[model samples]
Target: MKPYKNKINRIRSFALALIFIGFVVMYFGIFFKQYPLVMVIFMVLGLLCIIASTVVYFWIGMLSTKAVQVVCPNCGKATKMLGRVDMCGHCREPLTLDPELEGKEFDESYNRKKPAQSGE
Candidate 1:
């Protein structure tokens, strides 16, 4: 089975990674101190990454407001879920808001809009 994580947690992880990457990029810039232009370029790129991460963090706050808060049946813990299918943040148990999807295998594709069926 594919590894599944809570939507919010996944996005948060991405943001954290971006911050780490930004620091790493900036650290690399120190190595190019001999060349002022190259060092400046690296610093700018690093700053952009940090800025992007801040934007993503803000976006997460917006998404959190839209996420549904529910008690996980498997873990018995309150968790926020986004989209049609999400996993429990604590236990990684698959969750769904749609009755039709219950008992079916967990698939992230279910969150995507389906193409219209053509009449054969």
Candidate 2:
């Protein structure tokens, strides 16, 4: 089976990982204290990672407002879905907005087609 993840949950995990990465980079800067230039670079890179993560978190907040809240049929728990398809955050069950795609295997490719290019 293809590996897929709930979009929101995946994004949240990415943000969390970014914060950890930022801290790790900053920690590594300590070892370059003798070369102030290298230390500054590491510190700046770490700060940028942290800032980028903050932006991603804010983006998620905005996306949440537009996401569809549905009760997953598989897990019977509420979860948010983005675009035309998403997986259940709790059970990883595939969910779709388009009736035609119903029962189809969950593929991220379904979300990438441009409507105009497809002549839709």
TM-scores for all candidates: the values are 0.93, 0.90
The sequence of per-residue lDDT tens digits that candidate 1 reaches over residues 10-116 is: 99999999999999999899999999999999999999999999999999989999899999998799999998999999999999999999999888888989933
Q: Which candidate is the best by lDDT?
A: 1
What is the lDDT of every predicted structure here? 0.93, 0.91
Model 2 root-mean-square deviation: 3.2
Please give the range of 10 consecutive residues that has the lowest summed lDDT in model 1. Answer: 111-120
Candidate 2 wrong stretches, greater than 4 Å: 114-120
Collision pairs in model 2: none
C-alpha lDDT of candidate 2 relative to the true structure: 0.91
Q: Give residue 21's lDDT in candidate 2 (0 to 100).
A: 100
